[model samples]
Target: MTHISKYRMKSRVEKRIKDNFLRSILSGGSARRQAILGELLTQTEKIMLAKRLAMIVMLENDFSYYRISKTLKVSTSTLKRLHRHILAGSYRQILTSLTGNRADAIIRFLEKILEFRMPPIAGPGRWKFLDERRK
Candidate 1:
């Protein structure tokens, strides 16, 4: 859970300032970026960021809401919001960055990680047949 200050800011930062900050972060080398993020984000914040990215990746892979919810322990409402963002094409750049050129390989790997075992087929009739044959 993130804690936001109750006090509102008197003024919002300009878009250009925000864009410049983001650009500076993105322009760094991978190690520098990792170091900056490590210093900037709290552990909980990092977990939240990872989960959101995972949710987006899983959604793109066509995973069911139930599966994603069960696996990630996130609520359906969160998935719904992300889905809306996805439909709006809000995540295209983020998705591309997350998956890179090996999208198929990455998705396949995520699919394997997300896979769950289904219960074997069973019924009262089958159980009864087995009991009779044993007798």
Candidate 2:
């Protein structure tokens, strides 16, 4: 059997994201661009993903919103809408593999989520630990 690389897959996904974002800008914010990226972030409508990619692009880039808006020809609102989802941990299931190793896959998924989470919660908060009991 042939092996697939997680790094390669990650690059592909990141490329798609960059292409979609840049295309969204160059094409005057075409509906097609929006649709393509919108679908990848949803997961049975139960999870969120892609916050890191978006943050890296927007924050690291010096381009202003108006410049992006003008370049993509999209309203600031549309870009903001997608940005919100990415930042809010709304997109999901950003990983997949051809192997049968469930444990490795889950660890990768959780890592991706944690990387996006700020000051990522290390301990339970407002939620009871499995060992904790109430009076």
Candidate 3:
């Protein structure tokens, strides 16, 4: 019967997925990460995904205003604003100011605006805004 055949096919595909997931977990990718990804694939919002990806590209690099603008296909002014935001804003605030909505400067200048005074954490990529939080 067609129903029986479909069930068998689904079972086979699920087995392969389970096997691959087991291997990934054994390699220490984190059980949470594996579980979250394994919960059936789904679609994402294009704009939000693009914004988050752009944020990642900017954060992961020692990028200039012009460089980030070019890479993210946004205007130079917009990139400047994001730079300003990173310095002046908290994590939640930065998330809000995404998409060319905010000024660019060394993070120190932005920190001055926010009156955010915090001690620095030691380590690579420790505190996000170095120019602001670091000596």
Maximum-lDDT candidate: 1
- Candidate ordering by TM-score (highest first): 1, 3, 2
List model 2 lDDT by residue over 62-101, tens digit each: 4466654554345677667766675676543432222245
Candidate 2: where are CA atoms >4 Å away? 1-62, 91-135
Q: After superposition, how far is residue 13 of candidate 2 from its true place, in Å?
A: 27
**Tens digits of lDDT, candidate 3, 47-70:** 445544465345534556665555
TM-score of each: 0.69, 0.25, 0.30
**Segments in model 3 whose C-alpha atoms lie over 4 Å from true places:** 1-45, 56-60, 92-135
Worst 10 residues of 3 by lDDT: 99-108
In Å, residue 17's CA in model 2 sits off its true spot by 24
TM-score computed on alpha carbons, candidate 3: 0.30
TM-score top scorer? 1
- How many steric overlaps are in each model, in order? 0, 8, 4
Q: Which whole-number lDDT from 0 to 100 does residue 118 have in model 3?
A: 52
Q: Give the true-structure RMSD of model 3.
A: 15.8
